[model samples]
Structures are given as C-alpha cells and as structure tokens.
Target: MTRSLKKGPFVDYHLLKKVRSSDVLNKRIIKTWSRRSMIIPEMIGFTFAVHNGKNFIPVFVTENMVGHKLGEFSPTRVFKGHSGDKNSKNLKGSKNVVRKK
Candidate 1:
C-alpha cells in the first residue's frame, strides 16, 4: 500500500537533517540505514550509502529516482544463476554434435 498523499513522502527526519547540512559541491557520501525512507527532490545530486543486510551499497540520487524507496536501489539478495546438469558439461565439450531444423 502507498502512503497517504496528505502526509507527504516519508523521508526520515534524521536523514533529512543530514541532507540539509550536506553541501552539494562537496560530493560527500551520506551513510544511512533508513531503507524505508522515500527519495525526495532535495536528495538529487547527493550520494547515499544505503545499508543492505550485510553492507552499505552506494546509491547516487537523481531526478529519475525520486518517489522511489531507498531500499529499491540497494538489493538485499545475491543472484547466483541456476546450476547446470551433469550432462550439460559433456555436451559443451562435444562440438561434433549435429542439430536438425
């Protein structure tokens, strides 16, 4: 469910303070664990270190990222592709196999 429009976007109070104090010219990374916080217009041009479960992943905010959750940019899970079957390896080593249309 989306947040109530009347209440406005949920930008963390502490994070907001950090954004306010940070200088856009310096390009400093503002580390934050507020994954639930929404990205606001003021956050554009600033780099944020959003915490995943294990570590902090850097996310540079841009106008296109506005209205999205901070967590959306920092993925929590690692994708290790599907495992190949035992026969798949043998098939790869054999180049003489022929295919019919």
Candidate 2:
C-alpha cells in the first residue's frame, strides 16, 4: 500500500538533515539504516549506504529514483539459487548435440 497523499512522502528527518549538511561535490557516502524512507529530489546525485540487515549496500540516487523507497534498491535476501544438480548433469551430456549454425 502507498502512503496517504495528504500526509506527504515519508522522508526521514535525520537523513534529510545529513544530506543538507554534506557537500554534494565531496562524494562522501551517507550511511543510513532507514530503508523505509522515500527518495526525494533533494537526494539526487548523492550516494547512500542503506543497511540490508547484515550489511550496508551502496545506492546512488538519480532523478529516476525519485519517490521510490530506499529499501527497493538494497536487497535483503541472498539468492543461492534452486536446489538439485539434475539439470547440470543433463546439460553436460548434451554438449555433443548438433547445433544449428
């Protein structure tokens, strides 16, 4: 569900303050744990280190990311892929198959 338009976008006060205090030309990464905070226009051109449970992931904010949640860029889960090696064994045996060139 989306936030109520009347309440406005949910931008963390502390995060905003940090962005304002830092110089954009310095290229310093602003570390933050507030993944739920929404990205605003003011955050453009700044790099953010958003916490993803175990570690912080770097998220470079651009104009296209405006209005999106910070968490959307930082993934929480590590995809190890599906179980079973049956497909791999079959593929190895089929290497001799003729190909349409």
Candidate 1 local Cα displacement, residue 22, angstroms: 1.0
lDDT of each: 0.94, 0.94
Give a tens-digit lDDT track for model 1, residues 19-96. Answer: 999999999999999999999999999999999989999999999999999999999999999887967668856877
| Candidate 1 Cα misplacement greater than 4 A, ranges | 89-101
| Candidate 2 all-Cα RMSD | 4.6
For candidate 2, which ten residues in a row score worst on lDDT? 86-95
Per-residue CA lDDT of model 2 for 1-96, tens digit only, reads 888999999988999999999988999999999999999998999999999999999999999999999999999999998789777767746877
Instruction: Report lDDT (Cα) of residue 89, candidate 1.
Output: 69
Compared to the true structure, candidate 1 yields what TM-score? 0.84
How many Å off is the CA of 56 in candidate 2? 0.9
Report how far residue 71 has shifted in candidate 1, in Å: 0.5
Q: How many residue pairs clash (N, CA or C atoms closer than 3 angstroms) in each of the candidate models, in the order given?
A: 0, 0
